[model samples]
Target: MRLFLAAIFISLAVGFVNACSPADKAALLAFKAALNEPYLKIFDSWKPSSTKCCSDFYGVSCDPTTGRVADIILRGESEDPIFEKAGRSGYMTGSLSPALCKLDRLSTLIVADWKAISGEIPACIPSSLPKLRILDLAGNQISGKIPADIGSLGRLTVLNLADNRISGCIPASIVNLGSLMHLDLNNNQLTGAIPSDIGKLTMMSRALLSKNQLTGSIPVSFSNIYRLADLDLSMNKLSGLIPGQFGSMRVLSTLNLDSNQFYGNIPSSLLSSSGLNVLNTSRNNLEGELPDVFGPETYFSVLDLSYNKFKGPIPKSLSSVRYIGHLDLSYNHLCGTIPIGEPFEHLGASSFANNDCLCGSPLRTC
Candidate 1:
């Protein structure tokens, strides 16, 4: 089945999840009914081989030892969500129930994208499900401050609440989700400064707080999230120097800080990210030399450093990146002879557009 369970790839000890008790299996059955979408034909759409338990039901994955549902994927074997067929859309809007806390053994709950769900998130989310590891509630019309209580779900690994109408400042308590690995709260109506201690989520691999109303300096502690893989905070009201520690995230792959009020040179550390693939910091007050390695086949594949006050020779060693596809370095004070080489030849002239003195292969003359 193409039903990939990305959240299942965790660092949990193998021995711990190998066994499940019968009682746990029963809890899982009841939890299924408690989960949202009671009217949806998903669980009831087809009669499973066994009626006693929904363990082998569609979108359900059970612990092999205990025969209890460990994961719930609402998609069918055909790789299609039951309700989202080509010519049809669902409109079974209703309130979410607090009874979902019964699924004590569940590690992931991904019901956010369903267009039919509306109403407040279950406040009992944190207190009831101690073992909950992943909670995705994106692309919903969910209203209300995020239940501040979710901070208690220490075992949570991924919390995605993006594209919602959620308001209120991100509570300071959110920093307490110690084991959180991915937090996506983009495109919301959230207000207030990016919390200072937000960097405390050391286990975070991806964080997206863009397209909101947040205002403040990028936190220094942000660099402390060594496990961080993606950080996007664009189109906000942030000001001040981009945090130098941003380069400290050794595992960082994507860094976007565009459309902000940042000043000063981007820390060279960010330029040297070994695992970085995408780097975008356009439309800011940045100054100084851009990394000398943003050329052809460097570590990053897609880079956008346009619309900044950067002044310096373009880095000449960028011909190393063979996988580069998109490069936008226009609208800067850059001055240099673009290397008329294989890697540079493959890139578009827009990459060197609006530069004061950029010349070479991307252009006909200097």
Candidate 2:
């Protein structure tokens, strides 16, 4: 009977040792103590009584082999059953704990959309979390500059800090993220020119940096990002000629440079590219005749060139395009009869309105 009791005691002791380590547990507790998630009680599961933090803790996951915490995904906007049960979204108000940097094994840390979670992002994250692959703290009230050493995370794939109050110039070291794929710093208070070598992120597919105080001409190196599909530099103070090299990008389809200070003619190669479907250069200082490079292969879903200084008649070549779902050429110095073709049949006078002397079936007769 004594032998049996000893065996059972040994088994229990081993199980306890295999559970979350003491240091990790302490770090997690400190991390939780900083935040208050009142509605869903998400932290209720993160209790000292539940020793197996790997399986028992909410929004926390650990490696099966090492029992080390690997991920902490807590989003305020989730369709989790907890949100459904509460009939509302998650809401947490507090600062992120620096203790999170203690979880050295953490691979993904996403505490996003917690509207009131305000504080500067812990600067030690990039150095402490070497295994981090995804760092999405977007849609929070987090303020401060992005970590300068963010490029140290060699395996990072997604870095989204959008819809926040983050300020300061984008760190030049950001272009060193060789594995970064999706970079979103949209709707932030970011200022200054984008990193000149941003195209060095060869694996990047979408680069969204709109609605900031960014200035400087579009980088000529942007054409080097062969995989980049969507590029939005809108609502900024950027100026200079839109690079003609942009027309050569093999996969770039959506290019938005609107509401800026760009000057010079629209590149003909941009209109000639068969892959580009959405091009908006509105509210800029761009002038010159519309590029007469449209062909049967041209297919633009949205072509907005309004509110510019473009002069000259509407390009007759535009009529040869396969499709142009939405075309806006208003508020320019364009004059002459609107080109009559299948592409222009559905367009209304508003498209050609406010032009210097434009006249056609849509507008008053010439």
Candidate 3:
């Protein structure tokens, strides 16, 4: 009786093993064969003989009912111990395998933190993975233009391809990404003007495109991104006046447009923004008086408006800010008495250096 029951249990186990899709297993094997895994032996268990494709692989998960691949989270570098150990040498090389698109049910595909994954992203990826909600290939060596039809991935909410070798203009088709919220393509070799209709991404909260070769003026349509909270376009070739519509972002907190070629007066709407905390427009061609809109509730902590062409007295309202940790108004045309406040007193003369005419504690008295 004991021997018969053991045999029945073995039979049930074999039935469960057969439930995993053969196509998904074949795709995983193809992907493994494409990678150069000399240092990272994480795919040792991806044996073709093993029937448990989903359960035995290092970064694969499948739905129990359908036995289809649901997530492929093979992160090379991260704070996680397993990923760090696998990518410790930072040498996982090879082109991305097109076989990855065979997993029909895949919703999340994150292969980030591997700086050695070279070559162009498969052009068919956008059409092949319609169910993908989060596609992050950040901090890799992937080169080539962003897929022109990337907007077809309607389900994607977060698209991060930052810190790569991607070049060419951002496709206007990306405006079709209606559900995208976080779009980061910073630190790349991309050129050309920002798409005029980028404001169509209404769900965007953080749009970081700094440290690139992007040129052209701020698009007037940017006023449509009403939910934008953190906008960083620093260290680029972007020129033109800072858009006054940006001040309308009620939730905006961090705005870094430093090291650009933007000219014209600082927008009054931006100066009066109550939600702003970190504002840096240093090294621009702006010319105007500093705004006197600072209030007790104003969350200005880091105000860097240095190397501009402002001309006027330092605003007395600067004393109203309760928490200013970083302030630099040096190298401007301003002529006035420096405000002697808590944070201002702590600042050095360098903060007010190279101005046309300045006086008070940090400098010689007028």
Model 2 compared with the native: what TM-score? 0.94
Estimate the Cα RMSD of every predicted model relative to the unseen true structure: 8.3, 3.2, 3.0
Q: How high is the CA lDDT of each candidate model?
A: 0.73, 0.91, 0.85
Query: Which digits, one per residue and each the tens of the lDDT, describe model 2 over residues 1-366?
Result: 999999998887666544787789888999999999999999999998778887678988887667788889999999999999999987888988999999999999999998888889999999999999999999988899999999999899999999999999999989989999999999999999988888899999999999999998888888899999999999999999999888889899999999999999999999999889899999999999998889999999999999999998888989899999999999999999888986799998888889899998789988
Name model 1 segments beyond 4 Å from true: 1-40, 43-78, 81-92, 101-106, 291-297, 317-324
TM-scores, all models, native as reference: 0.76, 0.94, 0.91
The sequence of per-residue lDDT tens digits that candidate 3 reaches over residues 311-365 is 9998898787777788899999999788877778789999899999999988998
Q: Alpha carbon lDDT of residue 229, candidate 1?
A: 87
The numbered model that scores best in TM-score is 2
Residue-pair clashes per prediction, in order, are 7, 0, 0
lDDT: which candidate is best? 2
What would the per-residue lDDT of candidate 1 be over residues 1-366, giving only the tens digit for each residue? 233443344323233343334455445445444445544566563332344343335565656555445665442113365545533443334545665565666777776566655677888878887888888877777778888777898899889888878888887888899999889999988888878988799888889999988887888888788888889999888899987676666688899999989998888777766667888999999999877654342566677889999888877666655555677779999888876554677788888888888888767576
Measured with C-alpha atoms, the lDDT of residue 217 in candidate 2 is 80
Angstrom error of the Cα, residue 12, model 2: value is: 9.1
